[model samples]
Target: MSEWLQLPFVQNALLGGLLAGILCGIMGTYVVANRIAYLAGGIAHAAYGGVGLALFFGLSPLLGVLGFTLAGALIMGWLYLRERHRADTAIGVLWAFGMAVGVLFTDLTPGYNVDLMSYLFGSILAISRGSLAAMAALIVAIGLFVICFYRDLAAVSYDDEFARARGIPVTALQLLLIVSVALSVVVLIRVVGLILVIALLTIAPYMAEKRCRSLASMMVMSSLLNCLFAVVGLGLSIRFNVTSGPAIICVASLAYFAFMGWLALRRRA
Candidate 1:
């Protein structure tokens, strides 16, 4: 492990994994609490449109994706709040558009040289300094927002009607949460990609929810669990020469099954 740590690519992979775990762990609590797990993948897939746009225009993919994701979040959030029935249709539309635009742009680009495998699966070891910096900043921002709005979010999460009656800006807060999911997807895509992001976001939170008594504790434990998966997955990938993202997801899945088995034993006892 020490020798591997000395390698620059390994170091970047570890750091990238850490950031992904932390960001997903925190925001994932909100996603699970609200029963909006499905929203994450949609927003993530839609961000591919941004990536495509950026690639087409020779701009930074991160910046382009961020802009596109924010737009998708707003549209989804508003649809969800105003007409829950209509949101799925819009999500479907955005999902298709995102993928279509990405493919179209990539095709049109002359000598379009990009790593689709890395985007689709993951490329943690290839993380650049700028990506790391952006991820850290976004994670910090998310942590602060979650901390500041703990009480309000608690109300909204557990009882939306009660929160609304208490004069909480449910619409605004919901939009903010959805946007945060977008930011999380951006960070997580490097570790797991849009295709597998929901697993990374939800698996830890689900396990954490089983033992935690409050939302706050769930976030903390989920973050820890995510960190565990990231580290273990990186180790497994290194040892076996496997893909990092899927390796992590497999670890998370194993842990989930283990937790479920323990619960069953306890119930039988």
Candidate 2:
């Protein structure tokens, strides 16, 4: 394992995993607290359209994901705000449409026989330094956003009606939260892939939520837990010659169940 850490690719994977974990931890707190996991999942799957578009047009796939996901986030955010009760129907539509668009574009691309599994299941070991820079920038941006609007976001998350009564611009904050989820999805897709991104996003935060009394504490603990999972999973993958993404999720899943069982036992006691 020490020898693996000496490799440049391994180092990059570690850094990427940490960055991804932090990003997911912060954004995922809101995702879980606000019950927007389904919405976040929609944004994630919808990002595949960006992948296909980028492939067809010979553009950077990450850029394509960013563009498509932001657009989807905005559309979904609006639909959620305007038709809260019927939002799921619209989210499902966008989710399916985005994936369909991706598949169509990939089919149309001439001689583009790239492995789709990498995008679907992630290739964390193959992450580039450029992607790392983008992830860092996003973390900084999101960190600043959270610092600036911590109280309002917290208020909105726990009680939007009360937040609105206090003149907290609940609608705008909600839209920003949705957009933030989209950006977080972009960061995580490279680490966990779109299909598994939601699990990484929610798992640590979900676990932390049960233990922490405050959202800020939950975010901090979740970030630490995500980083731990990444390290353990990466190590396990190296040891067993398994896929890194699934290995990471497996670690998180096991921990989640263990924690749940502990809580259940304590309640029985």
Candidate 3:
């Protein structure tokens, strides 16, 4: 591991994994608490539009993805407030539309020979210093924001009506949660890609929640699980020459299912 850290790309990948793990843990807790996994996945796939636009404009793909997904998140959050029952319908529509538009834009862009695979499966080796810096900043900002409003968020996450009864501005907090979720999705796109991003966001937290009592404990356990999976997966990828993103996610899935199986056995016994 020490020798691995000596390589610049390895260092970048490690940093990227750390940031991605933090984002996943924090945002994922909100997702679980709010039952918004499908919604978050919709936002992630919708970010493909931003990626395609970035290719067309010769700009940073991450920025474009962030903007597009943030817009989609806001729209979904607003719709959920007015029509909770139809929110899933709205997400499905945007998810398909965004991906379709992205494909069209990528096809139309001249001399744009970008491989869609990296974006789909992630390429942490492609993580640059600038992107890493931006990711770090976003992670810090997200951490700070969550810390400042954790109580309100926890209340709203557990019971929106109760939060409202307590004058917690549940609506605004929900919006903020979704927005943060969208941003976290963007940050994770680099490490897990758009395709498996949802899994990375959900799996560790899901498993951690099983062993943890509070959201804070879940975050800590999730982060530790994420880091372990990331590092071990990256090492395995290096040895096997496989894709890191899917490798990490696969490990997470194994851990998640294994825990579930154990829980089931315990219940039966």
Q: Which predicted model would earn the best TM-score?
A: 2
Off by over 4 Å in 2: none
**Which residue pairs in model 2 clash with each other?**
none
On residues 176-237, what C-alpha lDDT tens digit does candidate 2 reach at each position? 99998998888778666876578778999999999899999999999999999988988899
Query: RMSD (Cα, Å) of candidate 3?
Result: 1.6
On TM-score, the stronger of 2 and 3 is: 2
Candidate 1 Cα errors over 4 Å, as ranges: none
User: Candidates' lDDT values, in order?
Assistant: 0.83, 0.89, 0.83
lDDT per residue for candidate 1 within 46-87, as digits (tens), equals 877787788899988778878888888778777777876667
Which of 1 and 3 is the better model by lDDT? 1
Q: 1 or 2, which is superior by lDDT?
A: 2
**Model 1 residue 205 lDDT score:** 95
Residue range 1-269, candidate 3, lDDT tens digits: 57877999988887787777777877887787678888888888888888888888877887788889899889878887777787888889998998887888899899887677877888987788877877778788989988999989899998888999998999988998889888877876766687667876788888887778888998888878888888877888876888888888788888888989999999999
Q: What is the clash count for each candidate, in the order shown? A: 0, 0, 0
Ranking by TM-score: 2, 3, 1
